[model samples]
Target: MTPTGDELLAMLSALANPLRLRIVAQLAGGRDYVSHLAREIGISRPLLHMHLQRLEAAGLIVGSLELSDDGKAMKYYEVVDFDLHLTASALAEAVRTLPPTDQEKP
Candidate 1:
């Protein structure tokens, strides 16, 4: 189902963090195990899992349990959709809410 304006805003807010953004970017490449993501993104496993949970709550990503060749259970995460087309109004709203940069600060 398509998300509403409020849902989009909440999702965007969840993604506004730098670490979460990086995690999303990495997931965009392909599905990856949580541990692998933590290693690749240079964050702690617990912290990565926390961010993953937030992303999942936003409905931006999904996770599933998988078994490795060595018989270990792993959680893999992937972007829910490769094509996320935001409405023009939503895009405008997002742009308007961006934080001011150092140069733009009063």
Candidate 2:
């Protein structure tokens, strides 16, 4: 899907961080729970949650709360199926849909 200018910007901004990039790379392998993902990525759960929230906001990753066998709650995250084909034409189209900002107005 062609993202709007704001969406494109959000996705780019979300991916611009090294930590977020690592989170995406780790999730690319498979879906994982919060603690496991944190351990694999070598970051604290809270920090990972911040990154995950950004990814989720950008539509790059999705999370779901599930119950473990023992009935404990676990939050799992997985990379969403998304294909972003960025090109000049795509950017132009996206820009056209952008809302006017104060700085953009005369």
Candidate 3:
């Protein structure tokens, strides 16, 4: 399937941040619960949640809520298989097709 301009923008935006990149790298190793992920990445849970939301929205990650043995719902995050092989020409073409962002508006 062809990717939408918005999808490409969102994925790029999500990966642009250092924290989010680390989150992606950590999730790459294995599926992880939020608490453990935050601790391992040296970030707070809320902050981690924000980054996870962006990644999830961008289709770079997937999250599922499951009931644990204690009957508590735990959210687990895993990396999605999105091998983006972007070349300079492809990126330029994509950018050429992008509608003007807010900053470009008068």
Candidate 4:
């Protein structure tokens, strides 16, 4: 499904980070667990989790829980199938649809 204006902005914001971009690149190969991703990406689990949450919220990635061999629960994440053709006009239109920021608040 095509993302709504706010949804597109959220997805764009989620991908704006370098670390999150790397996470996307890694997950592009295959689904992976948080610990493994943190190790591979050279970051802490907490940090990875923060980025993962954002990606999941933006619908850029999907996460599922699984029981490992030793009966341990693991959460794995993978990129979702989302196609976005971000042209200048598309971005401008999307940006125009966003609600005013807190700075605009009285």
Candidate 5:
């Protein structure tokens, strides 16, 4: 289903953070454990988890619980889809809302 404006905004907002973007990019590779992501992204485990929860809520990613060989439970996350699937209008709207770059400043 096509996302509504608010949904789009939430998704965009979730992605606005640099660390979140990195998380999405990493998830695009394949399913990965939260601990692995935290280490790779260089963010504290708690902070990374907070960002991940937001991303999951936005439907940008999904997490599944798994049992490791050691019998420890772990949560692994993966991008819902390989593509971002933003509509043209959404892209245009987002671009319009962006602040002017240095080149655009007088």
Candidate 6:
């Protein structure tokens, strides 16, 4: 689905951070639980969660809660299969469908 301008902006903003980009790259390899993902990325779980929430809010990634073998609930995250086609024409089309932003209002 073609994202609306606001959605596009959200996705881009979410990925603008280096840590967030790294998080996406790591998840691109495979789905992983929060604890393992935090460890692999060498960041604290709380910080990882902050980035994860941003990705999730942008629809770039999704998280699901599941029970581990020991009956512990774990949150697993994976990247969403989204294709962003950015070009002059695409941007124009997206802008055409965009709702006016605060700055755009007189």
Order of candidate numbers by TM-score, starting with the best: 2, 6, 4, 3, 5, 1
> Model 4 — TM-score against the truth?
0.84
Highest TM-score model number: 2
Q: Report the candidate with higher lDDT, 2 versus 6.
A: 2
Candidate 1 local lDDT, 1-106, one digit each (tens): 4455566667878889999999999999999998889999999999998999999998889999988899999999999883557788757765656666799999
The local lDDT score (0 to 100) that residue 89 gets in candidate 4 is 81
Residue pairs that clash (backbone atoms under 3 angstroms), model 6: none
Q: Candidate 1 at 96: error in angstroms? A: 18
Best candidate, lDDT-wise? 2
The lDDT for every candidate, in the order shown, is 0.86, 0.95, 0.90, 0.92, 0.86, 0.94
Between which residue pairs do clashes occur in model 1?
none
lDDT tens digits, residue span 1-35, model 6: 67888888899999999999999999999999999
Ranked candidates, highest lDDT first: 2, 6, 4, 3, 5, 1
Candidate 3 per-residue lDDT, tens place, 8-79, comes to 789999999999999999999999999999999999999999999999999999999999999999999999
Between candidates 2 and 5, name the one with more favorable lDDT.
Answer: 2
* Alpha-carbon runs more than 4 Å astray in model 4: 92-106
Q: Per-residue lDDT for 86 in model 2?
A: 96
> Which portions of model 2 miss their true places by more than 4 Å?
none
The deviation in Å at residue 56 for candidate 5 is 0.5
Candidate 5 clash pair list: none
Q: All predictions: root-mean-square deviation over Cα? A: 7.3, 1.1, 2.9, 2.8, 7.3, 1.6
lDDT of 2 at 45: 95
Q: Mind sharing the TM-score for model 3?
A: 0.84
Off by over 4 Å in 3: 100-106
lDDT, candidate 2, 18-103, per-residue tens: 99999999989999999999999899999999999999999999999999999999999999988899999999999999988899
User: For residue 79, what is the lDDT in candidate 6?
Assistant: 98
The deviation in Å at residue 85 for candidate 4 is 0.4
The TM-score measured for candidate 2 stands at: 0.94
